[model samples]
Target: MADGLARVREQIAAASARVGRTPEDVRLIAACKTFDADTVREAIGCEQMVFGENYVQEAKVKWPDLKDEYPHTELHLIGPLQTNKAREAVALFDAIHSLDRHSLAKALSRQCENQERHPVMFVQVNTGEERQKSGVLPGEADDFIAACRNLYGLNVAGLMCIPPAGQPPEQHFDLLAKIAARNGLSELSMGMSSDYATAVAYGATNVRVGSAIFGNRFYPPAGQ
Candidate 1:
């Protein structure tokens, strides 16, 4: 794991240099979804302070307990969030990278109003137009971002996207960068394990990596 992390870090540095940018310009968010606490702790030991999770329930189980052991780590909720879970998410996460609609934004805002701190959020754009994905369609990106910006208690930090699997990732990432540029937004969260290098070259501010860093995910038996 240590060797893998070192290699990944070197890759990130090299990719950043290739684009004429510094490594500091990109944030590598270790995606910890489906991994156990001990593995996550190992990642923390490697000085990886930013982590991304897909399931709210799983994160709730890991974050608080791990916080005492890894106090400096920042948790980002990068999953499809349910409106009913908004309050818990706002309370526990440092950021929500999948804010896809006005109602979800409003719910998060309301929850933040009572919380000690509000989480930074990004509007997830469905750049590949996947029917099963949770994101605002590309054409609706501007309106959705505008709506989020108008909401109270929510800091509209940037944008996030997951391009269709198996396709060349550069095309999707490039489109995302263009959209963000046109809207005057500075942040882009558009990379994952497989195509993160391509993402870096195309201007991804945050890359959410899981298997590339943690190895293959282990799922429990059918009934758990």
Candidate 2:
């Protein structure tokens, strides 16, 4: 585990250097989906303060237990959030990276209002235009950003995206950076375990990584 974190640190340093940006400028969000608490604790010991989770239920189970142990750690919701779970998400996560639609945004806003926690949010953009992905199409990004800005209890901090698999992820990162720039947006949340370095070069403020850092996930049987 120490060796893995050391290697990840080296990669982050090199990647930051390649892009002429300080390593501190790029925040590494350790995607802890399916990883156990001990593994997350190990990451915390390695000084990884930001953790990303995919599911509300899984996070609800994990975060409460971990937060007491790692008080300074920040939790980010990096999955497609459902409207029904917005209240819990607002109460638990420090930031949400998968806010894609107006209805979800509105629900989150109301939830935030009730909780009195202004959670940072990102508008997910479907850079690859994948029909199955949960993000706004490129053409509609402007309107979405505008709508998010008007939401009272949410902070429209940036943009997030997941590029198509097997394709050069740089293309998607470049598109996201361009769109964010045109829209006067500052934050770009793109990239993952395999393509995070490319994302940094293209302008990713936050990178979500899982397998590379924590190794493969272990899932139970469907009935479990």
Candidate 1: clashing pairs of residues = none
**How far does residue 31 in candidate 2 sit from its true spot (Å)?**
0.5
lDDT of 1 by residue, 44-160 (tens): 888888999998999989889898877788999988999999989987899899999888988888888877678888889999999998899999998888787774546887899
**Candidate 2 lDDT over residue span 1-224, tens digit each:** 66766776688789989879887888889999999898899888888899999999999998998998888999999999999999899989999999898889899989887888888899899999998889999999988888888754469888999999889888889989988998788988998988888888888889998888888888899999
Off by over 4 Å in 1: none
Model 1 has an lDDT value of 0.87
Every candidate's lDDT: 0.87, 0.89
**Per-model root-mean-square deviation over C-alphas:** 1.2, 1.2
Which candidate should be chosen as best, given lDDT against the real structure? 2
